[model samples]
Target: MKFLSFSILLMILHFTTYSQTIDTAGYIRGEMHSSDDSLVGYFKFDHTFGQNGQSVWYKKDLQTTKTKRFQTYKYDYFTSDSLYMELFEVMPYGFGEIRVMVPRVINGPIQLFYFPHSTPFAIIQPKNEPYLIKTANWKKRVSYRKFKRDMREVLGESSLVYKQIEQETLKYDDIPMIVRLANMNADESTIQDYIAHKKSAATSTN
Candidate 1:
């Protein structure tokens, strides 16, 4: 009877250890994406004890040299009882990059979020309520206005390009040089224009 009890205890301990090992609060969880949205490498995060945690991930072709590196981040929850996770990328030079924390939230579950190819913005209020906030960063808001205008133009152009590409593909039934070029150009232009617009808007708003 004693031997049987001891065996059960061992089994329980093993299960407990396994459970602890599998529990991770916030993590990258999968693979890193390349510039063109291709899966290049894998990353993993293991959190043990306390609110503070660390993560290690592999990024491929990080620099112009096409070299890969194992990037690490220092992470913490926004609040002690909060589910939101905050991560700061540790860089060798200057201040680290701050990004919003994404959590897996549940065990044995896959959570996927889309990152749109655009910039984000925050609102700023003037100290004086009646003050007319015409400029941001003491610069004319013309750049910001131009950016929004450019984005709309690019989106319209890309839509037309895509439609032409689809029609040509149907007619040719094969990859043609012109069609490929148009499609690629449209995609690149769209992303570039969107980013430019976002930057301008953010600057103006600030």
Candidate 2:
């Protein structure tokens, strides 16, 4: 009887330690909608232990759309957790299926993901290394004002179209300059940095 009690106590202690660790994963949740009224689906954060890939639960609203054909689906490809996810879907046109379009930059062994749909982009630079600057050196030119005018001149896009041309991204330095110029909302510290950079860029152009 004493042996049995000791074994049970040991088992409980073992599970209590590991179970708490398993339950402390991090994630973010968001809703999808075509308009103010038509809520199409939602993207839920999910995680797994000892797994190769990540998954997200996509849910559709049956009551608002007057349809019962679909319930929820799980996509199994993403592989990041506990990191700040900037945005998951496109802005302004935020609705419908949660398109998990993750564009990665791999240099040797390190990989970095940036630019979420609605979240502010995070830029992290390594200590010292070669950076692949892919876009035109617009920041080095006259000013942000002149750069916008030139974008309209060449691309005929005067509006902030940062999302459309993100695929052309190529370097770390270009990120903050572009992001600050676009005036996107971000964390307080990041916003302060953007403002400083913007002011510096304006001063440099003058």
Candidate 3:
């Protein structure tokens, strides 16, 4: 009877850790994303977790992962806006490079966007086909300078949105202004207020 009671106690403790608060400041409606659907795969979105020049955002803090130092980052989920899951380098401080994993179907082919580079450089294996790995969709890696040139050519020097993209990015600190303002209709002041509130709340918490 004692052994059975102990097992039940352990199970309760195990499941309780999976439920975590998802609201975080400076993160614009913090989102909880999970790749595995298990208790251990849920990742928390923390916008204020990195140092300058790194442009880091989400950590793999699934309550189980992040124990391994080298393999700590494995956030394989996307946002409702389809703009949150992107992999970016903030040191250059622009949208020059972006990567994301999009799910088209449950248990289907995971679409990976590898930024200014290839179209799905890595094939995320399905459960049934764990051995399948292909590079058929790989494209030439575009240099950062080349990608910037392409952006300028497409948007042109007089483009308001493109110019705003650059300006907004420079003005903001850690969060990517381009991605945050992608489909948002909020004005500049409103957005700034939101960000400021978030930062203030975060500072209070710590």
Candidate 4:
């Protein structure tokens, strides 16, 4: 009788611990998108725990999967606004490149990402550029001279945004507006072309 009672207590403890550790109630629906914006699959979204948790996905067929690093999760609830969370490679001051899941603030020729997890709270990736540019690192700091030079280099002379950077009219705080302007730049339409290329590649793969 004691052994049976102990076994029941163990089961109760197991369930109690699980309920506290995992937050299955906070599930949301979303679709998994590949790095190139291709749809990988659809699943219900959740974190292993409550608040700022790592992403988890569950399929309708009962299959489960963890978030794919460097991919994106498009939330279904934000249909009109279409919000996206993407995993990006971030290089913070005094550290090597690390991958963190962050939100894409502005999706354009020059994409702006918000990195709330660490220093250099913001980064930008220009169309076709392979590296992320840190907007400002509060620790190491960004000089105006270097900022202008780097923005010019990143935007390229042909881009209309480059003029603003060259003329010193835009500041670090104007990154979102600059990104919007970059999207408007006719020369930067290569981003659209790139998207088309990705779609073609995805179609071919399928």
Candidate 5:
């Protein structure tokens, strides 16, 4: 009886642990539609994990009155979890492009997932190094620096617009607790800073 109870307990523990692990092969898919209820586009995704790290592949198709646009991306590949989460870049080919992957907390099993969104044309890169910039522990300083650097890289030399976006981002960075409670807001600011910086840089180069 004692041995049988122990075996049952072990099985339960094993199942619980396995349940907590994310299946990288899993994906979430959906479509964009017009207000008139017409399908405007479709998206497919495949995320996987391996010895190297995590990788995300995305494909998008958009239909318009004039033409159809299609694009594919393989992004957020990294060797470390922190780097994978913070530093991976989104690179796309063709017309339909999505540059940002918003991290989402998966309920029940407790896993992280990415939801894609469209953004301006730019190179996607990690916000900052995890050790140097701890978004969790030192959110204000880390977020500020991350936003500043992203703006510089993306916008380049547009001092005016860079300063504008920097000020706005700094406001959000000041409230670490608020950021933690509302992760979506923080994610939005991160992407905004990236795009703002990219636009500023493009203008300067031109």
Candidate 6:
């Protein structure tokens, strides 16, 4: 009888440890939406892990303990810090479907996405353009002139940021802010304000 009790205790401990390892403590709660923006259902998912390159999603209710894997959903209305952020499942050039798109500026004059797994690490779509443009990360083999030319084409001559690119004031790291400013049709004053704020924030963090 004592041997049976000891074996049951060991089994309980092992299962408890396994459950703790895979629980939804840090998972983000979101509403999965279809391509047409139709609400599917509420779910919580951790993008960090899944089976066969897909993330595991669980029903939002903790008591039910139901889970699922998804690939057909277009995007999720993920909540972080009370802000609704869209997480897109995009197929980057020369890559598989494993990567996802984190939009820097969505539905803007110039759309930019940050792809962590791809070579360029960023993708751009110019206003009213059907095809997507790929870029190389600055830390890679791409040159400054190429990066500037790409930005100029995307920003256009009418944009204030185009002039900044012409004078070589912008770098690859500034792509996120550059896209945002260009979309805003930012003037010299607005651009300067954003630059100053960003510098101040960066300094404070350090």
* TM-score of each predicted structure versus truth: 0.18, 0.23, 0.23, 0.43, 0.22, 0.51
Model 2, position 173, has a per-residue lDDT of 36
Native-vs-model 4 lDDT? 0.43
Q: Evaluated with TM-score, which candidate comes out highest?
A: 6
Tell me the tens digit of each residue's lDDT in model 4 across 26-83: 3334454543443334433332222233454544333555444321223211111234
lDDT of 2: 0.32
lDDT of 5 by residue, 1-206 (tens): 33235335544543442232223343223432223432222333223323233334323433323433222223321222221222223333354322332232221111222322222233765343211122322311223345566434433444444454556643322222222223343355554554455456558899
- Measured on C-alpha atoms, candidate 6 has an lDDT of 0.47
Per-residue lDDT, model 6, residue 163, is 79
TM-score order, best first, reads 6, 4, 2, 3, 5, 1
lDDT of 3 by residue, 21-116 (tens): 122332222343456531222333432223221122343353333432211134434443323332233122144433222221111122222221
Model 5 CA RMSD to the hidden true structure, in angstroms: 18.4
Candidate 4: regions farther than 4 A off = 1-25, 33-81, 91-96, 120-146, 186-206
Write model 2 residue lDDT over 109-189, tens digit each, in one string.
Answer: 122233222312225422331111112332111122234343333223532433323333312334333433333433445
Q: What 10-residue stretch in candidate 2 is worst by lDDT?
A: 125-134
Better of 2 and 6 by lDDT: 6
Candidate 1 stretches with Cα past 4 Å from truth are 1-29, 34-37, 46-54, 58-69, 72-97, 104-206
* Clash counts for the predictions, in order: 0, 2, 0, 0, 8, 0
Question: After superposing candidate 5, which stretches have Cα over 4 Å from the reference?
Answer: 1-23, 26-29, 33-43, 46-69, 72-98, 104-176, 180-206
User: Least lDDT summed over 10 consecutive residues: which range in candidate 3?
Assistant: 126-135
Looking at model 3, residue 189 earns an lDDT score of: 65
Model 1 TM-score?
Answer: 0.18
lDDT of each: 0.30, 0.32, 0.32, 0.43, 0.33, 0.47
Name the best candidate (by lDDT): 6
Our tally of clashes for model 4 stands at 0
